[model samples]
Target: MTLLICAFAAIIATVKWYKDAPEGNMKLGILCWMYWGASIMWLVDAIFEYAELKAEYFTPAPADMLNDAFLGLAVVALGLIIWLVWLLIKDPRGVVKAALIRKKA
Candidate 1:
């Protein structure tokens, strides 16, 4: 299940990178941020589940732990996806400018 989640994430990251490659570095940066955010979320959830299993005398059922981890990751991923979509809506051009361009001539 973890592997499947990771694989889907990898595909999203790849597509985002490829989309940004030709246009602007900002898209790449945002996509990378989104990817890392997702990865970190899952990593933290896994650690927590690991600790939970270790602390209990009875090991958590595989299905239970897996469900918890999947739930946590899905929540985090959903938040990030929403934010990414918001960013896209806000910046339809997909460019991040350090400074606004002005007509001097």
Candidate 2:
């Protein structure tokens, strides 16, 4: 579940990054990298767990499934939060700088 969720996010971010490639913005690319890395990590985790659980891995408890889903969502949200903080610090479009200048007036 975590692998699937992060893979989807990575795919979406990759597409968006490709679309905006000419603009040279780094944020989308950063997001893509983060999600893809997470997906790969989770894929490895899944593989190891599957090896340990064998056939039983296919039949997770409902509670476990729900918990995995929540964890996946939380990971996605945290990635977004990290991206947002990076964006704010970078201020790529200078919105924050402009706002501060305006405030000085």
TM-score against truth, every candidate = 0.44, 0.91
In Å, residue 48's CA in model 1 sits off its true spot by: 6.0
* Alpha-carbon lDDT of model 1: 0.61
Off by over 4 Å in 1: 1-7, 24-28, 44-66, 69-73, 94-105
> In candidate 2, what are the lDDT values of residues 1-105, reduced to their tens digit?
778888999999899999888896657877998999989888999999999999999899999988888888898999999999999899898888888876634
lDDT of 1 by residue, 1-105 (tens): 453465466567667777767765434455455656666676787678667776562465798768956875775477468657766556656353323555477
List runs of model 2 lying over 4 Å from the truth: 24-26, 103-105
Question: Pick by lDDT: which candidate is best?
Answer: 2
TM-score of 1: 0.44
